[model samples]
Target: MPRFMGFVRMVEGGGMPPQALFDAMDKYIGEQAQAGHFLDGGGLFGTEDAVNFVVRKGETTRVDGPYAEAKEVVGGWALLQYDTLEEAIAGQQEFAELHAKYWPECEMVATLRQVSDEAPEAASA
Candidate 1:
């Protein structure tokens, strides 16, 4: 089975979902885990706790958030294993629908990216 990553982004200025909605999400995630669709997942703290780093030439610059230009931030992520890209996308759609149904007022986005099977090789001498 191929693996896919589902990236969950929260719109700027949107607060966390209510406890009832959070519980519903937890239940949905548990169902997916029990069905083997979910591999691993977790939510992240607000972007105010994040740090940004940029490397140019040989110099590395570190900047602390709140990021000025960021309109949205990753709020959570999930790793899913499926037989095909379409299946992965369908799964993501279902998850997004749950959010739409439960947190209608919240603005969120979910994106799916297929995971590569290739492993990195060591540098050649």
Candidate 2:
């Protein structure tokens, strides 16, 4: 089984989703969880107090957010496991459709990436 991380990115400060969307998601997630597809996931609050640590050259510096340039931020995420790429993609599409059907007005991007336990080839030393 391959594990994937699914991120739901949306515009900043969209306030809250409609209760209908929440209700729909609850039903959807509950079913997936019960079937052992969904591992864990949650929605995030606004990034008013977000912190970032950057290392440039040999120095490290800290930065705080509500970043002016960040138009879209990760609003929600899920940890999922499936049998194949097709299965993962199909699940991702279904999750995205929930947002499309419930919140047609807001723009969102659902990103799905496989989780790698080892470092990439570029990181080999």
Candidate 3:
């Protein structure tokens, strides 16, 4: 089985979604977990709380952000394991559809990427 990460990016300046939407998401997540498609997931704080470090020419510069002109910021993520990429995509599609149906006012984008098999230890060895 391959693992995938579903990145959820919310539109900037969008207000908090309704409680019913959260409830529906909770139920969907629970169902995915029960079906063994979902492994782990979590939401992140706003980008205002984030810090960025840039290393250039052996020097490091630290910067704070509401990161400039960003249209969307990653708001949440989910880890899913599936037999194929199509299955992983299908899972994300379902999530997107749920949002479309329940939280149409909340603009969002969901992207799916397969997890790489390479581990640090394996790469070093």
Best by TM-score: 2
Q: Ranking under TM-score, best-scoring first?
A: 2, 1, 3
TM-score (C-alpha) between model 1 and the true structure: 0.88
Q: Write candidate 2's Cα lDDT for 42-120 as tens digits.
A: 9887788888899999899999987889989998899999988898999999999998899788789999999996777
Query: Which stretches of model 3 miss by more than 4 angstroms?
Result: 119-125
Q: What range of 10 consecutive residues in model 3 has the weakest lDDT sum?
A: 116-125
TM values, all candidates: 0.88, 0.92, 0.88
lDDT tens digits, residues 4-87, model 3?
A: 999999876688878888999999999999999999998888888689899999999998878867889999998899998988
Q: Residue-pair clashes per candidate, as listed?
A: 0, 0, 0
Superposed on all Cα atoms, the candidates' RMSDs to the truth, in angstroms, are 2.3, 1.6, 2.8
On TM-score, the stronger of 2 and 3 is: 2
Off by over 4 Å in 2: 119-125
- lDDT-best of 1 and 3: 3
Best by lDDT: 2
Please give the ranking of all candidate structures by lDDT, highest first, separated by commas.
2, 3, 1
Give lDDT: candidate 2, residue 2.
Answer: 90
